[model samples]
Target chain A: MIAQFPALQVVIPLLGAPLCIILRRGALPWLIALLVSWAALAMAATLLSQVADGEIISYALGGWLAPLGIEYRIDTLNAFMLLLVAGTSSAVLPFAYKSVAKEIPQDRHYLFYSGFLLMLTGLLGMAITGDAFNVFVFIEISSLSSYAMIAMGRDRRALSAAFTYLVMGTVGATFFLIGVGLIYAVTGTLNMADLAERLPPLYQSRTVLAAFAFISVGILLKLALFPLHLWLPNAYTYAPSVVTAFLAATATKVAIYLLLRFGYTVFGAEFVFNIVPASEVLLTLALAGVIIASFVAIFQSDVKRLLAYSSVAQIGYIILGISYANVTGLTASIVHIFNHAVTKGALFLVMGCVAYAAGACRLESFAGLGKRMPLTMAAFVIAGLSLIGVPLTAGFISKWYLVLGAMEKGWWPVAAVILATSLLAAVYVWRVVEIAYFRDAPADAPPLSDPPLALLVPTWVLTGACVYFGIETSLSLGFAEQAAIQLMGGG
Target chain B: MKHHLIPRVIAKLTIPGILLFALYVQFHGDYGPGGGFQAGVIFGAGFILYGLVFGLENLRKVAPPQIVTAFIAVGVLLYGGVGVVSQILGANYLDYDVLSAVDHDGQHLGILLVELGVGITVAAVMMTIFMTFAGRLR
Candidate 1:
């Protein structure tokens, strides 16, 4: 059973999803989803522990041989990713129970849970699978379900948001598929490990270079990297709050993991860096994403859209770390993945509560929220602080490492930009704080209290994690260090 | 209202044959090109034909929406259950080799069960999608 942890990790959710729809009663689907998410979290924990000593755990589906059959491969990098993805789901689902009830119509509850599970399954499958083609399949699975989930939002614009996401996501998936096809054409294998072994010799081939270009662009679009991020703000803002929280935290993070996996693990850093000048391109884009997105975020009136743009900026930090192509840089990127997920998940949950109690997520809706919903607003403040990389927070640790990575490369301007962007983050976060605390509630406003305990508790748990992991730093940083080493060591 | 006797008669005649072929495709998947996905679509097509000629009201009578929704979950559960069963037998999840003493027999058994599960879910979901869209029309 322990040996099968990798498969069990994904199968439990895959199985539990259908069970959610089968039961099809109020709260039952949420309960089932909650249990399944927790179960997946436990499995991910076990898998991470198993791989903690830097051992790779590979499980062949149906007992078939690797390269000929599907394989679930767990390394330090994927193990960390699995934990992040599953942990975010576990944390977010509890909050989702109340949020979903308020946001989605009753008849669609079962479909919501089912779509959530399918999305979970897709993300886990993508992180665990060793086959390049399997990643594409899982991407589609998650993408299709997310489209459904996003469209479930009560807002009429949810339909357009889902449609826009669908069109863009399909193009991204197609590009990724074409890249995988080219790799297979040259190497005659779809297994990542097999391709890794075969690809080095073909590094100079135009086909391989074209494959890299397609795959990178596809993944960057999926990650919502700067300039390619037009679809994200509305998609995240208009989608049901739970969908926004989940996708904001995990979806782009998974895309970043793919970028790391393909860029470093499969393509090899030397070829990706020295041969193609990918680092410079990524660095330029990362800088632009951080500065431009942060500036854009500062001007947004919708809080969700603000955070959505902030997400693009945070992703820039992750990409910037990766562009350095050093252990510290990669470690910063990996650690930021977990940190940003915890921080954004908490912030979004708070926004959901505000939407629940106040009936809107616009900046003005936050007026006097600090008084009406003190704990909820406080949770937002803490997460907001983390977002700005204030000291004694998870965000600080990631930025610290990111700056260290920049300085190590003697890129002082990049380091300066990193700090300057945090100040921009501070400006945006402070806008919310000022509105929530300083402004008074309107005279005719309905009495609003903190959200129900079901929602509030989960929001705080993630907020607590943001602070806890920041101070402790052992679990997240330890895993991230090992993951960075593994990536740099060529897996 | 027109009875449309010719179309109704053709639908009535072909629906049973279509369903039978769907089952054949599902079960013969391991040895042939057709599998659960193909089988599910074919099965759903038969019901769609019935609804087109006999009316959705009559189709719903044959396959209630509530039961169809449950069927969707049941199929996925059936597929996942096989994997869980293998895990209980002390093999990896979805490790079908441990399902039977004979390796080849276990493989065949596992494939059959999984394909059946896929066929059931896909067919039910397709029907449910049609019902939802058609319900909107009414």
Candidate 2:
């Protein structure tokens, strides 16, 4: 039974999705989603602990062998990703129950829960699956559901946002499909380990090169790296608050994991970095994403949109860490996935609580919220500080590693740029903090306070995590360092 | 369309034939070219033909949205349920060798059940899609 943890990690949520639809009711589906997410988190924790000892756990689906059947492969990298994604889902659900009730139509709650669970299943499956094509299938499952969920938002613009995402996401998925096809065409294998073994000799082949290009671009679009990130802000801004929180935390992080997995494990670092000169292009883009997106984040009037742009900038930071290409840089990237998931997830969640209590999430809505909703505002401020990479928060730790990584690589300018962006982050974050604390609420505004305990608890849990992880790096940093070493060592 | 006698009569005769063929294809998938997806689309087309000639309300009467919705979830459950059962029986997930004491019999039963699950989901999902688009048209 314990051996089946990897399979159950995904299957539990997969089953819960349909069960939500089968037992469609107002709260029943939410209960099912909540339970399923908790179960997923539990399984993810077990898988991570099992893999912590440097053992790779692979479970073949349908009792078939690895090359023949679907495989759920978990190592230090994906096990940590599993924990991040599942843990986010678990935290988000308690908040979602209240958030969804307010944001979505009462009758459509079951549909929302169903889509939520499907998205959870998709992220988990993508993290765990060793089969390349299976990731495509799970991406579709998660993507299609998210499109629907995003479209469910009350704002009329949500429809267009979802449509834009649909177009971009489809093109991205199609490119990914083409990449997989080309790889399969050349190598006649889809399993990651087998492909890793098979791909080394064909490093010079143009087909393999094109496949790498396609795969990189596809994942880049999905992860919303700069210049390819036009679809993300609108999608995140207009999505229901819970959807925004969930996707912000897990979706792009999983995409990053995919990029690292393919670029490091399957393609081999020799071919990916040294052969293709991927480092410079990725580094330039990461720099651009960090500086430019942070500038954009500063001007947004809607707090959700502000946070959404901030998310784009943060993705820049994540990529910057990745583009460093050293173990410390990779560890920074890995830890940022967890750190950003909790930090950004908490910020969006607090925004949801604000939106729930205040009717809208515009800049005007947050004015003087520091007084009106003390606890929620405090959570927002803490998470905002984390977003700014303030010391004793999770964000500070990642940036520390990122800057240290750049210096280690003798890229002093890159290290300087990383520090400069932290100031920009401070600017954008302080914009919100100043608005909330310095201004006074208008007389016309609805009287507000901290949201119900349900919303507040989850918000604070994640906010507390931002501080806790910043102080205690043993768990997050330990796994990240281990995963980074494995990745850099070409395991 | 409902008032058009010739097309309606033709549809009435052809619908059952289409359905019979769909079931045949659905069951014969293991040995032949037909399988769940092909059979599902064919089966769905028969009902779509009924709605086209007889009206969607009539189609709804024949197959309620509630029941069709149930079929959608149940089909996936049936498919996944098989995998879970195999896992519980000490085989890998979806490994059907243990479905029965006799090895070949287990394979036959497993594939049959799995195909049935797929056939149900595909057909029901088709109906659901039609319901959504056709509902919008009205």
* After superposition, candidate 1 runs with Cα above 4 Å error: none
Kindly give the stretch of ten consecutive residues in candidate 1 chain A with the minimal lDDT sum: A61-70
Q: What's the lDDT for residue B138 in model 1?
A: 79
lDDT of each: 0.92, 0.91
Every model: iRMSD: 1.1, 1.0
Candidate 1 CAPRI classification by DockQ: medium
| Model 2, span A1-491: residue lDDT tens | 98878888888888888898889976999999999999889988988999998989888887788898888888999999999999999999999988999899988898899899999989998999999999999999999999999999889999999999999999999999999999999999999989999999999999999999999999999999998999999999899999999999999999999999999999999998889988888999989998999899989999899888888888888898888888999999999988999999999999899889988889877889999999988998899899989999999999999999999999999989888988888898888889899999988876778889999999999999999999999999999999999998888
Model 1 chain B lowest lDDT segment of ten: B1-10
Error of 2 at A435 (Å): 1.2
* Clashing residue pairs found in predicted model 2: A62-B93
Reproduced native contacts, each prediction: 0.76, 0.66
Error of 1 at A457 (Å): 1.1
